[model samples]
Target chain A: MTLKANEIKVGDTYSEEVCRNLSRTQIVQYAGASGDYNPVHTDQLYTSEIAGYPSVFAHGMLSMGMTGKMLTNYVGHGRLTSFGVRFTSQVFPGATLTATATVTGLREEGGENFVDLDVSTTDEDGTEVVKGTASARIDA
Target chain B: MAVDRFPIEAGHVMMFARSIGDADEIYYNEDYARSTEIGNIPAPPTFVQAGAQFDPDYFLRPRIGQEWFGSAKGPTGITQRSGSGGGSGGGGGGGGLHAEQHYVYHKQLKVGDVLSATTKPGKSWEKQGRRGGKLMFSESVTEYRDQAGELVVTATSVGVRTERPATSS
Candidate 1:
């Protein structure tokens, strides 16, 4: 069942696969869709030769968006009161990313119930790529 | 301040979902979406900010020698790294990075809706970095409203910039 405000506990955690593995097509598609054509994201030569990175990386927004998917999938859409994130590390190609959402706090304000969560994304090796928090309104 | 208008289209929504590796048909397939609770293409939560690429004066545009966070420049006036110190190069302020990002969705934005956005700087501060020296941060908030004047979304994003370390003693 979907998580409702009343049923959620402070320590509840949710985890899901966000991306199996990043590919160049998806990265370029993101650049085309989001209008961020930064060479470091799209041009492998620029990343390896100019930027000195082994491989091109995905945009931080891409990871954040994937994490957002985990929240919407579990809590349901339009329930997000607020969401925030910090870019912790770079995500490279062939890296599988999983997003975890942990409820950190619950509070009542102005007769409304809110669930606070610590959200994060990590690669297969457990390197945190993104970390942040989110708040959602649930039925009391 | 003037409001910048951005339109939401089905094609754009589909491409965005695909870009993020989200295969949910609701974002792309109209027939599949018609049966869902939303009954139409549902734009992803962060979709609105994706429209910023179309804004001529997009806030994240890199500036030279300007104090910036979020992948641009900074206040130090030191542009590129001399490669001697533990410095990351982007020419003075060209290499800013995003420190934090926040989004508050007031309503579900659907395809065919046009959003009007107004953005302004929110907070600016500085703090000591553990190793990167002085860190600069700036925050900006963009409020998106639907055609009916209903506040649809409020997005707050923060960026961090670090001064390049000195090369020589």
Candidate 2:
């Protein structure tokens, strides 16, 4: 589906309230599915005792997904072409994470419309958790 | 259950590609693959999972008592999945769902070149409830390197755990 100008415009922003905090059971489930089980995430003892983190943290990609959902929910379907992000900070369960995106670029070609968004996610204190850019093929 | 950072060879990619039945010329045909800008057979978008040790289903299904409602497909950016639920490589079903996945494109894996990937959860968190369900997010980072000590790829991914209200059917 193509996004109308009202759907997402440059400088447009949307904020979804943090609904659920992360947990070990979730990580273990992902590990079993994604084939990723590095102890740094699943083993609190390893993260605190061996890896040096106060507690097991969430995956950067996992956080990115939250950000991605924010963007996709706003833009709708069949309008996204490329999306990516970079991890800058660690996220622990129970923190209220706010995913935000700013529209930076937009254009339309013979047949396809292009919408570019600069995305940055932060925690309760405004810590940049993950920051990156995303490009979508919109209809507007 | 981190993706095994196994040394991937051309032969291995072929087998892996076959397992997914990608059947894309770029994944199997050398004569056709070399003709593209990628220069060689390329792995599918989901090929990153080649380094994994378990099926994608393990995370998609209800874990005994944990029944979560999710869309088959996630945000348009990138996606990754299932498998305590058993199936013979059935297509990773479609729904607007997003789970754990990380990608690090440090270098490209050319045809016949072997590479390995290692991954782990970087962090995790849970939210009370949104859209009538609780949400849990997990982040995992993946590192892909070759036997030659060269970094091939790096990715950090996230997952959303949203379980419907106990009263909802």
Best TM-score among the predictions, by candidate number: 1
| Candidates, DockQ | 0.40, 0.05
- Native-to-model Cα distance after best TM-score fit, residue B23 in candidate 2, in Å: 31
Best by lDDT: 1
| Reference-based TM-score of each model | 0.80, 0.48
Task: Please state the error at residue A57 of candidate 2 in Å.
Answer: 0.7
**Candidate 1 per-residue lDDT over residues B1-169, each given as its tens digit:** 2356788899998888888878776787888777776677878988886776657755434344553222323322235545553123431222456667788878888887788888899999999877668888889888888888899889888877666521210
Model 1 chain A poorest ten-residue lDDT run: A44-53
Error of 2 at B32 (Å): 36
- Residue range A1-140, candidate 1, lDDT tens digits: 14567787878899999998788888888878887655556666544444444666787888898898898887775578888898888788787999999999988899988888999999988989899989887777
lDDT of 1 at B143: 89
User: How high is the CA lDDT of each candidate model?
Assistant: 0.74, 0.54
lDDT for B110 (candidate 2): 66
